[model samples]
Target: MRTGGGTGAGAALVYGTGLAQGLALVCFPAASSILTAPTGYDLSPSRYGLMFAPQVVLAITAAALTPVLARRWTLQRVLVAGLVANLLAMVLLVLSQAPAPSGGAYLLLLAATGALGFGFGSCVSALNTFAAALVPGREDRSVLTLNVLLGLGTALAPMLIAVLLPRWWLLPVGVCVGLVLAIAVAWRVRLDPGPAAGPTAGTPKAVLPGRFWWYAAAVVLYGITETLFGNWSSLYLSGQRGLGVATASAALAAFWACVTVGRVIVAVLPARIPATAVYLLLPVLIVGANVAVSGASTAATAVLAYAAAGLACSAMLPLSISFAGREFPRLGATSAGELIAGYQIGYGVAAFGVAPLMAATGLALSGVYLVGAAVAAVLAAVAAVITRSGRRPDPSVPATPPVTTATRSDVPERP
Candidate 1:
């Protein structure tokens, strides 16, 4: 397949997906800090946890099933449908909350949250998966650069929301903006219209074997760290440590600012250092931050800790996903979605659900932090072992064998 020039729009969509995922990932992470039991939002702990729970499961199911679904619908069409649904859900939730939120209001919140989660979830998984497959080289710049874009979104979403919410309450506004972008680009842009766009396997493609499960586990473990810090940062500072909401919000924003920096730094030399080194570095840096948080005698220490930990974890997930995804092109969107599910489950277990049960350790926040460090340690060891002994197959991205008619990618699928 010959191509037309779209270096600009293609780049924007990639950046935009980063924005959408950043917002989707942080949508609840942002609100959970502000909308808790004390805030009188009437959204129970169980309800807040429930908002992410079903969405994670459905995202995994959607990621895997998206290939089949895409056979009939264009990827853009699917994205547009989900975006519209998400916008509706956000508007409904905002209206329900204004005059005084209720139990019924919480239900509406969850339903809308699920729609947005799945839409963002599916679009991200599809685009990233396809990018990995379609790139001309296995370890290509575009595929790797996506980590930077993703980091940009994740880091920016919280800070942007935190900064803007004070003036315009931009949750509704951000969703509206994203809906327009998704609609505009989904029509104007096309991402390599070929078999490279989706999964070709009927069932259980054997190229990756079972090693991808390790990748899934690594992400879930990594997510625990992110959840503990992201969902509970404000609470830890304000509720436990006796800081003002304004001070805590600044700490959280600073953390993401550091994350954006960390990703760009690590991205520069990703191929030089081994994956295991990045894995090992994360927990070590996080433990150092945890020490500061535990002994945050003043506001300055807390802010420093948040920033350091953000940089620590900034690149962990994208690195793991790239390493794990190298062999499993057939899984495509589903694999990405499943890993995200793993991420949410681990995050939910620590932040909203389990941490509350261990009430002794300052709502079990410290204990969860310790547990997350331990999980990261285990993943480093697991990654070391897998690097040495996993199913080794040729991972070369298929060459564009002279395009006569069907295109190089359509040649009976090479693994």
Candidate 2:
């Protein structure tokens, strides 16, 4: 398990990549004003929602491709490629802000977001896998820490946007410059190219294990709840709840800040504190918070409710991936990628599918919070089932042993 001198550098690189991912992700929701402004794209809510569809679709594709790509490339190489994509995405986004021909702006924006999705998906898959591999037995804590950095980036985006937009292009431009610096940092960091030590190492890869599907389903629900609130809360606060633009931005920032803070709390908790307890308890809190958001009459009430919802939902995604990695250590990256794909599917459904439903049914923005609550309730039941089923190890699978000397060649090939 010794990683030599590169462990510290690798860890820093992973966290830095996470910070960049968070900053990039927040741009979409944070830039909602410019994206839908009459002077800008003048996009309808449905159209704005549609813009996310490409990102989701491309992200799912990138995630699915990560494991396949990793077989031929070093994990660091894969990460670098993703970062390059992110830089391209940022540049494209900046360009989309320029005056363009009729309908060209929308097309350019979609292309930019699609690139962003590809970059985020690939980078996240690689970083999560790299972090898990760096600390063999502490996958949960490592993943949580990485995601905490990402949440910090997400939190910063809104505050930056509130101050910078009408000139939102600066956000992406800043991200692009950051990516350039991050890519350089990543190149200098050396990652341990070792096979993950686990009981299932030599076993034949099973075809989509039952437990993985359960985890995937749980993340789907998690994605729906998380993205629905993150993307829509600003609009809800401003348009429906009568908050000013800056106030709505502040609310969004508060929500992401809570998410970052909540993850930090979980990361430091005793390792013996079962993740199942968190999985189960968080959904109940999320359901309550969503209900609160639904009934919120003032900006203050809505901000508190959304922040609470962020706190409740913060650990669900990372924890689900951590659980899967622990259960199937040998397939750590592949399993994580699958779970991410499942998450993106849910995100797409919630982000894009919900908008038209709202348009048709005359559901207020808060009504979507109720829908998220229902999904979260289902996620809770799934978590309970996971808890019960995970009580004992499968007899068919053995516990993974600690890895001895392993090279890049020792890494398992794609199943």
Candidate 3:
């Protein structure tokens, strides 16, 4: 495990882990219909949302502790631990389906989600670090490639559910096998993610730079906007628009498919577009898509609107992490970990708060999309400020890698 670099087998495993993680992360959300249907878990809206509360709490804790744990446990050990947690989560989810809807079943689901939170927190943070190091100078593209795999897994989940229906537990069973494979690979590969951060990175007294807070805030807001679609799109379509379960599932899949395809397009686009430009423009698209989705009537319109929302979400998170990585090169894994924590905060807010807000305000799911549009607008404003700042890479390090065939035009604006 202490003998390999971040290429060849190790890189493939890292990317595969991303796909597996995507599948694991979306399992609960993808089964939202089944979990709440009369024939299924028979949960109320608030209860459905409340299921994620423990996940949020534990995920934040695991993610925020990555840098601290990495100092002693090493990134490899931390990743292995995350994988084991993920496996336990999938196993519990499968067991949860054995009993009919009852307190025992619900408790199993809660325990599974809590484990998933820890797994997602630690696993994703480490993967971001490894992905950034894969291509040396091309951190953004590398991360985008990894996320493409992740988005593909997410897209596949609901489609599988649409096909499998009541047998959705099989999906996590497959993911369990995948996790087992990933854990084996983690054990075999060292996955050196360049160099570790400076000594202060692990110190209890140390803090991230003030400028990093803007990126954190932007991601937190972005997380809320993303979850509004990821967690609620199916419910909105089936319940509000009178679409069938299959149609709603297809719409959700469409959103994730576009997210994958959009990242691919951005990664290989010929134009030397500034990353900041993409970052700022996406939130505007999100705003429009959210408004459109809220008013959609037909299934076609709902699917298309959600697809647009997915495209808007495609590259934003990777870009944010990459940007912060470039600005503060020495922070290494800590930067990604902290940003993940921020995004999970937003995730928690949207996951639990939406139902309560709807109940208190007497607004429908459509109105929630409208509110998400406002949040996207705020995200746009934050992106504008980040772009204007235009922080350059560290002066002590070389501006470009000494390796291969990438020309000046292939790279995005560094900041």
Candidate 4:
């Protein structure tokens, strides 16, 4: 925070955690893709899909559990646990090799999901908590930067792994290196201590006022847009644009690259703008980008559109997380996890349904983008309304006590 507004302690921890997340996501996604390659493991299309579905479910559930884990265990400890889980998963996957036995693949998949869940859940939770404590009033733009940097890390992993693995056996070998790097980075930092709400820090008893759910839903809706592209932009580019698969992948990479850039920009934006205003802008940006993505006939147009989408979607989560955490401090980490889980669920559902719908109706990828745009628009309106109208209720007392010298006595003293 010497240069930025956040404290150095919080910044270091978040940045390191971001690195770890990047490494984990990068390694997991890239390493697993080779599973179904006939020349490699020869898994069936359906089987490959099944193998990965568990990963998503487990990861999403684990992410949602972050708040509970954080309350029970400090953020750093949880992350350490996650790292250990990641190491174990990698070992099992490496050892379970050769012809893919149904038992072995699923075992490895479960282990991997556990590992990912641990790493993702703990780090995301800890970092958000740490950030809230450190950055007092400076949440919005700063979080955007974190999101961008993290996206860059995620996006860069596949390309790097692709380059490393072309020589055959070196692919899985690189995964070990990544896992170690992720662990090392996570080890170097510490989470800023969470709020001193004492017993209610992160509990079912943790109060979630109406305002909290409002922000959570906003994040959920916005998140669907982000995850949709992340999961399928390459396929859309390849199939719809008639670009070679490699070329389409490059487009997807560009999307991530722009996401990072957009996050950086938003992070530096002026504080004069209200959160409501920023939230409202998200839908507008998303619609424009999605339209570009679907309607573009040329590769250049595709890249530009998807990249804009990445950039536009970048700040949506950061803004929502910041708003939710501060607006409902008691539910800070829990809401963060909830919103993230919502996003993942939306992603999973959309991924399964959208592609098939397009295939069946002969609707172009444009149709998919159009639908996503509509969703984004609805989310924007809701966020604006919530930001403008909803007020966080006092969780400490069922009713606001009559103001008097004695009423002040019940207010919890700040740590």
| lDDT (tens digit, per residue) of candidate 2 on 1-415 | 2333137777877888899899998787677777777876688877787787788998999887776666656556678898998998888778876654347878888888898899988999888777666665556677789999999999988778877856767888888888998888777666653365221333444356676688889988988888877777767888888877766766677788999999998888765576667777998988998898888777778788878988998888888887666656566567777788889988888877776889898998888789878888998899887767764333335753433211111111211
Instruction: Indicate which candidate wins on lDDT.
Output: 3
Q: Which stretches of candidate 4 lie over 4 Å from their true place?
A: 1-10, 31-33, 89-107, 167-190, 196-204, 359-362, 390-415
**What would the per-residue lDDT of candidate 1 be over residues 107-158, giving only the tens digit for each residue?**
7666766766666556665555545544444323344466666666666666
Residue by residue across 1-415, what tens digits does model 3's lDDT show? 5555556887888889999998998898888878888888887877877788889998999989888888777777788999999999999999987784988888998999999999999998888888877766677778888888888888887778667876788899999999999998888878877653422335552367777788899999999999998888877988988887777877788889999999987777644676667888999999999999999989899889989999999988888887777666667778888999999999989988888899999989999999999999999999887777745444434654422224123222332
Candidate 3: regions farther than 4 A off: 196-206, 393-415
Model 4, range 1-415, lDDT digits (tens) per residue? 1222145644765665565466556565565456667655667666655555665676687777776776777555565665666566656556656535556665666566566655565566555555655544455544565676677777777777777775433544555565566566555644454453223334454655665676667766776677667766766777767876676776777778877887777666555544566567877899788777778778778777777887888777767776665445556567667777766676667756676878898877668888888888888787777767535443654454322111111211111
Which of candidates 1 and 4 reaches a greater TM-score?
Answer: 4
Error of 2 at 360 (Å): 5.6
How many residue pairs clash per model? 2, 3, 0, 0
> Best candidate, TM-score-wise?
3
- Candidate 1 residue runs with Cα over 4 Å from true position: 1-6, 28-54, 67-82, 97-99, 133-135, 138-144, 158-167, 193-198, 201-208, 270-276, 356-363, 394-415
What C-alpha lDDT, on a 0 to 100 scale, does residue 280 get in candidate 3? Answer: 83
lDDT scores of the candidates, listed in order: 0.60, 0.76, 0.82, 0.63
Which is superior by lDDT, 1 or 3? 3
User: Roughly what TM-score does model 4 have, to 2 decimal places?
Assistant: 0.83
